[model samples]
Target: MPDAGTLQLSGAGTTKTLPCHAGYLSVSGKNNTITLTGHCTSVTVSGNDNRVAVDSTDALSASGAGNVVVYHWGSPKIVSAGTANVVRQG
Candidate 1:
C-alpha cells in the first residue's frame, strides 16, 4: 500500500536531489537520477535507468532495468523485478 501523501517523481529532470520529509516516495520516470536525504518509510521505483540514493529506508521496491538504489542506515526490505538493477546497503 502507498501512502496517501507521498512524494512522487515523474518526467525528466537533471539529477534531482531531495530530502525525504514524507513517509513514502514513488519514482516513475526515465533517466532520473535522484539523491534523497533523511529517512523514508517506503520507496518505490518503476522506471528505467533511474539512479536513487537514500539515507535510509524501511521498505523498498524496484521494477526497472539498470536502476540503482543505495541506502545507508536501517535494515531495508527490498524487492527487485528486472535486470541490471542494483541495491546497496551500508
Candidate 2:
C-alpha cells in the first residue's frame, strides 16, 4: 500500500506496518497490530483485539471486540460496532 489503493488484510496474531497514501484500508481477523502512515480516505477494522494507528483519515469504521484506533490528524467521522472498541484522536 505504498500509493493510493485499497488494502485488505485478514489473519490472526500478526503484525504489520502499512505503507503511506492509501485510498482505503480494511482489516479482518483477530489480534493483528497495524500502523498506517500518510493520509487515507477510509479505514475499516473488524474482528477482535486489533490495534491500529493512522496518521490521518477521513472516515473510520471499527467493529468487533476490543479493537483500538488512534488518529493523529483531522476530525474524522467514526462509526463503531460491537463491544469495547475504542476510537480516539491523538
Candidate 3:
C-alpha cells in the first residue's frame, strides 16, 4: 500500500516532471527520466536505466541496475542497492 501523499510513476522510455509537495515519490521501470520539483519527504526508485532528479529530499533510495538519482539540495539519507545504482547530492 502507498501513502496518501505518495506519487508514483512507472513505465519505460517516458519523461515527466511533477511536484513533490514534501511528500513521497516512487518510480519504477526502464529508461525513464523524471524531474521532481518542490520538497520531497522521500524518494524511491527501482528498475533499470532510470534517471531521477529531485530539487530536495529528506530521504532517497535507489535500487535495481543502472538507476541514477540526483538531489540538488538537502542532506538526504541515501540508500543504493543492486548493480550500478547511484544516489547522490548534486
Candidate 4:
C-alpha cells in the first residue's frame, strides 16, 4: 500500500472501513518481498499480479492464518484486524 494509513477495506453489506479481525498484524520480508500471516482475516486490495497498487478481499473468519499471496510484482501489503504486513521492495 502506498500509504498504510490510507489502506481500508469492506465486506458484504458493510461499510468501507479499516480491516477488523482481532487486534494483531504481522509483516515480514527482505528488501520488499515480504510474507504476511497471522491473526488477521478477510482481506481486500485494489490491484494484483505485480500492480503497484493492489487490493485483496477475503473473509476474516476463514483465513485468520495460513493464507499466502504470491504476487509477481508490486509491494507487500496486508491489512486486517488481527495482523498485517506492509513493505516496499523488489
Best by lDDT: 2
Residue 15 error, candidate 4, Å: 28
lDDT of each residue in 1-90, candidate 2, tens digit only: 847789999999989887658589998999999999889999999999999999999999999999999999999999999999999998
- lDDT against the true structure, per candidate, is 0.83, 0.92, 0.90, 0.28
Single out the weakest 10-residue window by summed lDDT for candidate 3.
Answer: 1-10
TM-score to native of every candidate shown = 0.87, 0.94, 0.93, 0.22
User: Residue 65, candidate 3: how far off, in angstroms?
Assistant: 0.4
Report the C-alpha lDDT of model 3 over 20-89, residue by residue, as the tens digit: 8888989999999999888899999999999999999999999999999999987999888899998888
Ranking by TM-score: 2, 3, 1, 4
**How many clashing pairs in candidate 4?**
21
Model 4 ranges with Cα > 4 A deviation? 1-34, 50-90
Deviation in Å, model 3, residue 70 alpha carbon: 0.3
Tell how far residue 17 is off in model 1, in angstroms: 1.5
Q: Name the runs in model 3 displaced over 4 angstroms.
A: 1-4
lDDT of 4 at 45: 30
Pairs of colliding residues, candidate 3: none
Candidate 1 per-residue lDDT, tens place, 1-90, comes to 233358888886548877786468899877898888888888898878888889998888998788888998888999999988888885
Q: Which of the two candidates, 2 or 3, achieves a greater TM-score against the reference?
A: 2
Clashes of 1: 0
Model 1: what TM-score? 0.87
